[model samples]
Target: MAVPEDWMGAPPRQPVDLHTDRPHAARVYDVLLGGKTNYPADREAAEQTLAALPNAGAIARQNRAFMQRAARHLVSEAGIRQFLDIGTGIPTSPNLHEIVQATAPQARVVYADNDPIVLAHSRALHTSHPHGRTAYIQADLCRPGEILRNPALREVSDNFEAKGSHVNARSKGEVLRFFHGLDLVDPGLTVVHRWRPDTVEVGAAGWSDADIPLYAGLGRTS
Candidate 1:
């Protein structure tokens, strides 16, 4: 089914700029999840990585489930109405906005990523419920102050960081520093699998708690 012009938002303010020959983390992740948004180089890189780590695909799925669980926790338990999700890869089903808005239709979400491919597909992520809102920012996380000060994040009450991001091989303490001033929620900075796993959502990629590759933390600005 084609999305009619009237249903879509305004065109992206900037043209999509990307290098198809280079393998990018965002695109590789898309390929791992069986998405068609990636280039041949991304698929090739993903295949090579999977060949090296046979469970790579499964771990990727688990990571995505972890994201959904975090969003669910924020909406159901924390009563958070706004969210800022960094390192947001290609928009996948049950995205942060989808998961949160399903329960709290007025939830507002901002997704930020440095990848050009992610920017290209950000339009899909911009769609929100009639009562909710969502936005995307193309940004590099190295500048923490920038993300914290971005206009889009001004209304964010809760900031969620899915740790163990490939670029982040830092010690746990170093990673926790990112949320220093904020108050952490229950099960603070724990492994993804340990954060109130929703079995129904994890499906076949339900790897052991110890096997989850990423760490997830939620913090409030209070």
Candidate 2:
């Protein structure tokens, strides 16, 4: 069944429904990260947001970095081999799977998102280490019960809930509601930049508590 060495391993590509006219959150984030997978509408919306909040772009990038660091912590420190990443955005390099698999190649990840565009480009997420596995689900969180009952989400062992959708301010009590039943890991629910900061430059950047509007806490359901 082996093909000749001169043969190309993969087949040709086909057309996918990108819906170039509409703007999706994942695509809009891709545009902010300077990725090329976005459409004109996404760019326009991003530009408008940027015009209103000059710090918006920086916030997005900072959030992305925090996500990576948090995933790495889960794998390296917490020894989590399973991940259920809801609201999973467009596949960027060193994605959640990539980061976790780096330390634990047997890690399994299920990325769920509501965006059709994310579903279209999900093939990238399928690439897992030979010892690991990855899957994607197209579902909306509007139906929280359905998401909770999903087979993929049920497979996750190490649980964490940190979402990027909140651009508005949230009180600490509101944030603690997310971890009502679960036990929080050390350094519970703080600004993204302050979470186990690696270097003095980042930890001492003089970023105010209000500079970042997002709250993230790592918790376990045990």
Candidate 3:
């Protein structure tokens, strides 16, 4: 896919070094999703994890489904047009940008991940629509401040004119900070499954109010 024209002048391309010797979380996820972008070590690690917990793949899928639904809600109902998604895994169909842009073509998205493989594929796969904007940054979740401060990432947040349209980070501290300056939607800062549980079983199996690996909620910036 061709790079979007808007992103063409954004920044210089960073070198991506594919480390195939060890297992990476993004590659493991790709293997679980049956994508062809993983190494042998990743497949081996993923198989071991699956053996230990059969529900691992289901959990990943559920997380992804939650992300899609959340992005859609932010765009369609909440009227958010800017997103900062960190720990973004491999480029899957209906990515964050795709979901939001589909609902509102003016939506802007900034995807960040530490994995080199994800960076490479994201560079190729995350093209924006003519009017919308999409950009990727190779960064780690541990450095939330750095990611938020990135020039490319800041551009998306800077463009938001509405209260809820600015960049919202996806970590525990960041999520809290985001909500501190904003009003969370009803049923605030819950686990993914708790946001809109599909079934009783899903709710029972996935609810974790204390320490959910993923924290998601919609809020209007104030």
Model 3: lDDT equals 0.74
**Candidate 2 lDDT by residue in tens digits, 104-221:** 9999887888876786687654587888877666678766556666655555443544332332345877777767778887788888777776654343387787876777777776
lDDT string, candidate 3, 55-158, tens digits = 67766766777788777778888788888888788888878988898889988888888876887888877788888988888787766667766778776667
Top candidate on TM-score is 2
lDDT of 3 at 181: 71
Tell me the lDDT of candidate 1: 0.74
**lDDT for every model?**
0.74, 0.74, 0.74
Q: For each candidate, what TM-score against the reference?
A: 0.75, 0.78, 0.73
Ranking by lDDT: 3, 1, 2
Q: What TM-score does candidate 1 get on C-alpha atoms?
A: 0.75
Give the Cα RMSD of candidate 3.
5.8
Instruction: Give candidate 2 misplaced runs (Cα > 4 Å).
Output: 1-16, 124-126, 148-169, 199-204
10 residues in a row with least lDDT, candidate 1: 3-12
- The true-versus-predicted C-alpha distance at residue 180 of model 1, in Å, is 4.7
Which scores better on TM-score, 1 or 2?
Answer: 2
